[model samples]
Target: MLHTNARPSDRHRPRGARGFGLAESLVALSLLALLLASGLRGGTALRDRWATAGARDALVALVHEARSRAVERGGAVVVLDASTHVARLESGGDSVRQLRLASEFGVQLDLGARDEVRLVFDAAGVGRMASRSLHLTRGASSARLVVSTYGRVR
Candidate 1:
């Protein structure tokens, strides 16, 4: 008979069974936190960019809708009221449509020298105003909707 100095429990245990130590777990947790922080910052920036794009598209759509309504109704005027942060359509002294801008989008409109900017469209779907630029800004991003003298939106 051979004699060995091993306990009965040790004899039944797997040789290479190991688990993560406290220090290793702490390091992993720290790395995870760092990654989460970076991801959160990136997400915030992406959200802002998305909001800016949405606001710009909304502005373009408003202009196009106003022009279409003018053509359909024989003539129309689109009013961008800064005080209300809304775009309103009027045709033949009757209200057509109103689009309210979301405050979270941070859209700033530069309509030159008017508190309420008006873009007039004739029955021919041509802009009746002189060549003008409408600036739309959100945070650091900006887009310009140019209304040419020929009544074209570029």
Candidate 2:
């Protein structure tokens, strides 16, 4: 058997530096909690932005579809009604599509001077109305879909 000069109490002692004190541990925990909270807030803002973008894209696509359909079918394609939260498309008195916006997105439509805007596209892909701007808004952010008299969307 090997002989050792160390005392019995020395065996129970830590080999090197001691672990963190109570105050140090508390400070670390508080920092971690603050970091987590900020991350959560960022995530929520990102989600809201995504939803707003999605809603705007969908609206633009609907307009394009109606325009194309009017040219192909050789008749009028109409966006029958558009309000703060909904838009309806119709071709030849038949429902083409309907889009309902979510409340969380807070989307609003601003078709100037019109309670409900009827967007009419003729067979030649020309709009009956003059050049106008259709505004889509979510909170402070907004997107504009401009409709020219020549039936161009930008």
Candidate 3:
């Protein structure tokens, strides 16, 4: 009374048994897409922040450079901005250098109520403008870069 043939379950299993169900596949795909989208958005935000910060630091450096140059060369140095975003330094009608910041950085210098901004530093490293506030803005946030008289550059 021994049975020679095996039962149907023992003979074979479905080849696609290891594969995920349709619902499971759909959910996994959706999660992956969401993750990818968020990562891309975060990267974009980070890039914008980095560009804005770099531009701000460059502006600060330009101010310090102009002051230092005036003291070192024993002459008057000028930090002027012909446009809102572009800034340069000059000494005795000669352009000392052009800053690396351009309009693409999203940095705007708002003079507030002033007609123009022409910061001049004397040979003794003293600011001639007395007291002034230069606005540095990126997107919705802004900060003031103030310079006081007595050759002080802040």
Best candidate, TM-score: 1
Model 2 accuracy (lDDT, Cα):
0.73
lDDT of 1: 0.76
State in Å the error of residue 154, model 2.
1.4
lDDT of 1 by residue, 44-121 (tens): 767767776776677677778878887788988878877666777888889877766546476676677776878898
Task: Estimate the TM-score of every prediction.
Answer: 0.71, 0.68, 0.67
Which residue pairs collide in model 2, if any? none
lDDT tens digits, residue span 1-154, model 3: 8765755765575655556889999999999999999998777767666766776677678778888888887755545453546677887778887664446576666777764677888888787776777766666556566677654545
User: Lowest summed-lDDT stretch of 10 residues in model 2?
Assistant: 75-84
Decide which is better by lDDT, 1 or 2: 1
Candidate 3: list runs displaced more than 4 Å. Answer: 1-29, 36-49, 100-104
**lDDT tens string, model 2, 1-154?**
9887877877787787568999999999999999999998787667656776777788778778888888887655545234546777788778878877646456677777776767788887677877767777665566777777766778
